[model samples]
Each structure stands twice: as structure tokens, then as C-alpha cells.
Target: MSKDEMADFLRRRRDALSPDQVPATVTHPPGRRARRTPGLRREEVAAAAGVSVSYYERLEQARAPRPSPQVLAALGTALRLTAAEREHLARLAGQVPLGTNAVREPVSADAHRLLDRLGPIPAYLVDERQDIVAWNGAAVVLIIDFGLLPAKERNAVRLALRLRDTLCSAPAGAQGEFIRQSAAQLRAAGARYPADRVLGELVNEFAAHSPDFAASWRDHDVRPLPMLRKHLRHPELGELELERQTLLLPGTDLQLVMYTPDPGSPSAAALARAETHSR
Candidate 1:
């Protein structure tokens, strides 16, 4: 177990929280001195985690022994960690199995063939981190043109947070929901691959610049990508409504996302028109 990294993670998570966020069950000293740091005191965390103050202090100071699984679970609850965060904590403490950290598999040949055969449907592939790996032509025409973007800028979360004005054309509520889900997915990916420096940098960048993303991330919501309706406006096609479906390629972390228009709906006609226009 890397005590130093674990200690740093614990310290950062603690510092990020405000006093008001702590549970009501945690109480302060009857005549507490004025606090210097804004976050919870060591005693407060200890009280909430059901650990001794000295033990928690040793943990934060990186002087403690390897924490037991029970201790880790208690600490996770005390710190209000998400499911992903709790699992990450266990992995860091050497209590859980650690898989290939930060290593992403390439898109399989079968996935590439499927993408090709799904002609005129807006379909694309994204890695666990939501980075665009490959996209079909229909995705380029309907969604943001992935082919035109630099590889670094092709991430779904980054585009939603940083370039929403240019890439999003949905109602305010739909847009908000989309962004929230993106942030939550990114948070899950961060926990799953804690050693992924690129994911770390992307999170830092989004949290630094996007208040909406930062707030959603802090809520610790871990939601699977759901099949949902998306309202989009195209310069050429006017307004279109489509349903987005997510398909996980078996044995891989890649997600195949496809947008489909309901049969016989106006959206279908619009897509047909778009397809013909490209010919």
C-alpha cells in the first residue's frame, strides 16, 4: 500500500468538504477553540468515522499502519465518499483487487466493423474516460464533427463542459441533465483508473473552469449512462429529436453510443434528408 498517496488523497478529500456538509450526528467540543482551517477538524472526522482522534491524525499525517477494511469503510462513510470513491479507497489501501490501472484497450475490430455497418446512424465509440476513439460519418454530420477536432478536444465531457455553446442545442433542462451525467461518469472513471494522469488533468481543468461540472462532481452522483431523448438543432436540418442508446462492447470498456430517430417520425425524415444531402 502506498501510504503517502493514500494520505494525500484523504487530506484533499477532507479539505474539499465544508463543515455544513458533515452529518448532524457529528458534534463539536462544548467549548471549542476558534478553528483555523475551514474543513472539519481531525476530531470531527474521527467522531464521525468512529475512530480515535489520534488514529485519524496518524492517518492524515501518513504515520498510521495499514488500515483494515472495516476502518476504510468507516472512513469512507465519514468522508461522504461515493461508491466509486469508496472502491478507490479500498484499492489504494490494498484491500481490493487492482486491475490494469490507467491502461485503456484499443477499439476492437468487431466494433469498427459494427460502426461501419450502422450506416447513416449517428454512432461513435468512447473510452471509459469518455474520450472519443472512433466515429462514423453520420456522427460527424449530426453531432459535432469529431473528425475536425484535435484528439485532445474529442472527449464527450470536455466538449459538454467547455464547448457547450457550440456543440449543444438542447433545452436548458436537457442540457443541464446531460452535463450532470457527464460529470458523474467522469468521476466514476477517475475512481476506476486513479493512476490515469490524463483523466486527473481533465477533471482539474473542468473543475477549474466549469462551475456546473464542479458542483455535479461534488455531489458524488454515480449514474450509468441511460438511454434518453436528446433535442438537437442542426444548421441544415432545423430541429431534430433523437433517442440515444448506449451499447457496451463485450469484454471491453468501450461504449458504443448511437442516436436513432423513431421510425416514421419527422426526425427520421430529417435524417434521411441529411443522408441524401451528403450524397
Candidate 2:
């Protein structure tokens, strides 16, 4: 086991978190002294993980024995580690049967073909970090022309958080909800792929530039990008109500996200017209 690496990982994860972000169920010590530094103190983490402060300190200092699976699990929960982060921690402690840590699986030829066959449906592909990897012609018509943007700005969360007025035409309430969900998904991704440099940079960028996004991230909510009813604006078509269907490709982090309007509805007709114009 790489004790030094594990210790560093543990310390970084602990330092990244703030006390208010900790789960409410964790009980802080009675009359605990104020912390001079940021993040949960060693004693607070130990209390949350049901361990002694000295033991956690030893783990942080790379001087402790190999942690058991149970203790690791406790530490994961205490530190609010996501599934991917927990698996990474276990692997660092010499645990076998660990899952792969791959991120941003390449979009397959088959996936590309499927998007082409979708016709007027606004469809695109997103990696775990919600970066738009590919899209169909219909997506260009209905959503923004992703091809026009630089690759770094092609991320859904980054665009939504930084350019809501320009990217989203949904009603104010729905737009807010969409931003909230996007932030939550980003938080989960940040936990799952803590070593992803680009993802970390995106988070840091928004944290500096976007107060609402930073606030939402601090909530520590994690959820899959679920099926959502969204209102999108088209320059020629005005507004269209589209229901989003997300398909997580098996054995990969790629998500096939498509927006479809209800059959026989005005939005559907509008989408057909938009599709024709694109053709």
C-alpha cells in the first residue's frame, strides 16, 4: 500500500470540506472549541467516523496500520466521499476487487449512428463531467450550436452556471431548478473523479465567478441527471417544451440525452419545422 499517497488523499479530502457541509446527523463534540483553520477538525472527523482522533491523525500521518474495510467505509461516509472516491481509497489501502477509475469514455461509433437516426429529436452525448462530446443536427437547431463553442466551454454545467441567460430560455423557476440539478450533478462528479484536472478546474472557476453555483455545490447534494421537462428557446420557433430522456450507456460514463416533445403537441410540430429548416 502507498501509505503516503493514501495519507495525502485523506488529508486533501478532509481539508476540501467545510463543517457546515457535513451531514446534519453527525454530532459534534459538546462545547468544542472554535477551529482556527478551514474544514472539519481531526476530532470532528473521528467523531463522525466513530474513531479516535489519534487514530485518524495516525492515518493522516501515514503511521497507522492498514485500515479495515469497515473503517474505510466509516471514513468514506464521514468525509462524504462518493462511490468512485471510496473505491479509490480502498485501492490505495491495497484492497483488491476494486472498480476501474476510468472517466470520459470515448463516444462510440454506434452512439454516433444512433444520434443520426434520431432525426428531429434534439440529442447529444455527455461525459460524466457533463461535457458535450457530440450532438446531432437537431440538437444544433434546438439547443445552441455546440460546434460554434470552444471545446472547454462545451460543458453543460459550466455553460448553465456561467451563461444561464444566454443558454437557457426556460422560465425563471424552471431555469433555477435546472441550475440546481446541474450543480448537484457536478458535485457528485467532483467527488467521483477527484483527480480529474479539467473537472476540478471547472469547479474552481465557477466557485470564483459564480456565487449561486458555489452555494449549490456547498449543499452537497448528489443526484443523477434525471429525466426533466425543459423549456428551450429557438430563435425562429420561439419556446418549446421538451421532455429530456437520459440513457446511461452500459459500462460507461457516457449519457445519451435526448429532448423530445409530446406527440401531436405544438412543440412537436415546432420541432419538426426546426428539423426541416436544419435539413
Candidate 3:
């Protein structure tokens, strides 16, 4: 909650917005000076936000004292901030400390029983950070060869991004799309638990390694898991189409993801054959 850090963040946010995003019209007059600033001028933003230009400047400079909630809201609106950005701004302004431990600890016995009950479906539990906290036997068969992957890289998102490159000859586009979706999930989780180091590192690594991931992360698209049809070529099973569903484990920051084959499809038949082989 450092004021300097807040000021820096605000300035970066302001600089990131294009002039067109603001209300002002851009025009060039003959023999007149062209605008030299990168983003909307501070005065224009102050005017739109209904604050004194000097005060706004000082706030951006970290010289003004803490901003009031009303002022924060006005600024947020003027800047067209997203919900996540608005929350970050609120935390920075000392309006409230961001909550922590959103992922419930020591997942209850009942939850474990529920996961066990989901037998025969490729079901697994993931913490808010996307770590594989637990999984049913069927899950191991449908997804990665979990026994082969190292312990540290067992995270679903990480495996989808990094291991896919090595383990599967997936098309670049499919792999890229998978990384994009995983990054979006990570970002949504991040908005809720900003201080989670593991989440932050996963985001950084994916953004660094994948252009699609970096772009999607910047777009700030947050979506809970919708049914996703994945095209996968399993070494043992050949090819299969699977639908993935993510279910929230109530009272915990955990998700239960299960993969099922579409009914009446060859992929469904293949899954049945694979299940038999697994047993």
C-alpha cells in the first residue's frame, strides 16, 4: 500500500490509454503546435473526472494525499477502468485491503468424498492457483500422463502451456488457444487473489513464452469455464474429441474439471475403449 507505488500504477494506467479513448476530439490546425503528450493530457482527465487539475496532477505525482472514494470512482469512470482495475485502484488508494486466502485450506473430507463419487469421469480438483490438488484415476488417463510429469509441473495450466509443446504434436494454433484460455482463467483468479505468488508466476511465465497468452491477458477477458470441445491426439488412443466442464467446489477456491466425450461419436467409443484398457 505504498503511495509511490499507487502513483506509479495510476500514471502507467493513464499512459496506457489512447487519446481516442478519452472524450476529446483530435485535430491539427495549420501553423499550430501538435500535441506532444503520449496519452490524454492531465488537465483534460482532471476536467472529465471533476477534480482540480492541480490536485489531479499531484495525485498522479504522489504528492496529493489519499483520494476520497468519490474521487476514486470519478477517476475510474473517466479512465474507463475495468472492474479488476477499479479494485486494484481501490486497494492502492488504501480504501480497503484486498482479502486473502480465498482458496479454502484443508479441503474438507466431504469434498474429497464428492470427488471420489465422480468416478469413471475424468475429474480433478484444482486450487485457485490451478494446482492439481487431487484427481480421480480417470482424470489421469484422459489428460496428461501425470505419473510422468514432474511434481512441480503438475499444474493444469502450466502443463497445457509447457508440456504440450514437448509431449504432444498438437497444432500450434490449438496449443496457442489452449494457453490463451488458461491465461484468462489465471487472470480471473488473479483479480480475486492478487497476492498469490504462484498465480503471478504462472501468468508471467505464460506471457513471456506465448504471444497469444500475452495478448489475451492484456484483453482482461474473464470467463468461468464453459463447455470446451478439445481436439486431442493421444499417443495410446490415437485421436479424440472431449468436452471439458469446470465445476466450483462450494465453500472452497477449488474447481472440479471433468472431461467427457460427446455421445454417439467415435471419440466416445474410443474413450470407452481407453477406459477398458486403463482398467
Candidate 4:
């Protein structure tokens, strides 16, 4: 099923609960008005999932990142979801177990330190599936601030392919090439971890929604991480031509990407000017 199906199914499940079954329904803030909406409110589910209210809403909207297994378990318990309902929730969230040895590595401390030291350079980290795991302040200001995005929107693949991120709006072959690389990386992940529910859901969603991605897959293109040049047109910074470098972190599936302007290029001046305006 598509993310649309997942969203609708989650809404229906949330509505099925009686008012008494939810904690928020039972305990009201002093002298607050009775809840106007029927069924468990969004806050109720978020509290149960141990995530922020906005994050949970994004999940229902299918715009956030997939929840981890622990968060899913909390959500299942909070919603009073049965065993079958839990399985359905897993499928909807794109968080079904990958396999027996499936393990998600945390962003290493060294990765964090490296990004921090790459001053004035826009750098961010991505997982094997293109999930934006970590990013620096420069990354946020230069890029689209993936930190502020909903969990589901944190994936580079989703943002570039489906969500129409501004970075991809540049008039260059870079975005098109990125799409092809994305397809190849996804294919690699699927081969290595066939039971990865997250990858499965992502591929299904892309196959249904993105014609370019579908075409890339149909062509069976594969490319390794290479030093590629990208041009970006920012509303605030004008034209930027930067060299993209990908460094694979040892002992993890994470890759650090840094965008550096060539010396004496117009992009260098633009980046310097934009730095003053950056967060």
C-alpha cells in the first residue's frame, strides 16, 4: 500500500478508540474545555509514542521520517493496537524489521566532530538509504534545513524525488544524475537487506509517484560515489557552483557530504556573503 493508504489507515485506527481509552481524554488540564474532537487527539498519540506532537502529526501526514522500532512499539501500546494492528502500523510507518541481523548504527562521535570542524563548509550525513541522519548548522543554512523537516521528509531521496526541494530546482544535470544514483543506491540496499521494510516502502512509493526514478530503475544504472560538481540557485544567494565530495565513514553505513566552492569562483563569494545571513 502507498503512504496515502498508511495515513488514512492510521486516522481510522485513531478514531476507533473510545474517549475513556486515552489518557488525555481522562486527565484534562485544570478548567480546560472538554475536547471538541472525537477519538484520541494527536497529542494523545504523540505522548504515547514519546515523540513531539508535531512529529506525530507529520507521521499521520506521511511527511516525517519512519519511526524506529522502539517508537513503533510505544505507539502500538499507546493506541491499544492489537498484534495485527501493530503489524499494520509497522507496514504503514515503513519500519518493519529488516532481517535477523538488521542493525541501525548511530551517527558516530567522530562523524559529528568532523562536521563541526568543517567550518564555513556546508556538510551533512546520510545513511545507506539516504536518510539525513546528521547535519551541521552550515548545512541547515545552506541546505533546506532538514533538521526542521518532518521525520519522513528527512530522507534525501524523498526530498529530491517527491517533495520538490529547492536544491533540486537548479537548472543542471546534477539533480537528474542524483536521481539515477539514488536508484542505484536503493537497489544496492535492497540486495543487501531484502527484508528492509523501510527500503521496500520507499521503493514502492517512488515507483508509484516519481516517473524519473522509475525510468532510472528501468535503465538499471549503477554508479559509485564520485566527485561531482553541482550548481545551485538560491533565492538569497543567487548562483552557486560547488564541488560535492562524499567521504564514507569507516565502520558505518553513513557518508559525509561536503559542498565546497572552488577557489576564486563566483560561488566562493556568494557563500561568503551568505554566511553572514546564515543561522
**TM-score per candidate, in order?**
0.68, 0.66, 0.67, 0.60
Of 1 and 4, the candidate ranking higher by TM-score: 1
Write down the lDDT that model 3 would get.
0.72
Q: Which stretches in model 4 have alpha-carbon errors above 4 Å?
A: 1-102, 162-165
Predicted candidate 1 versus true structure: per-residue lDDT over 78-187, tens digit per residue: 88887777876776677876554555667777888899788768899988778899987778778777888899999877776665666555786776777677787776
Q: Which of 3 and 4 is ahead in TM-score?
A: 3
Best by TM-score: 1
RMSD of 1: 5.2
**Cα lDDT of model 2 by residue, 1-279, tens digit:** 668768877887888788888765453555756578988777778888999899999999999999999999999999989876686677678764432344445788999999999999999998877889999999888768899999988987776665566656567666666666667667655555556777767777876766666766665445455778888765678878988888877887788889999999999999888898888
Runs in model 3 deviating more than 4 A are: 2-49, 52-65, 75-85, 99-104, 117-120, 145-150, 166-171, 184-208, 211-229
Q: Give the poorly placed runs of model 1, Cα more than 4 Å off.
A: 1-94, 99-101
lDDT of 1 at 82: 72
The reply for model 2, stretches above 4 Å from the true place, is 1-106, 161-163
Provide the overall lDDT of each model, using Cα atoms, as 2-decimal numbers: 0.78, 0.77, 0.72, 0.72
**Pairs of residues clashing in candidate 2:** none
| Candidate 3 Cα deviation (angstroms), residue 180 | 3.6
Residue 110 of model 4 has an lDDT of 81
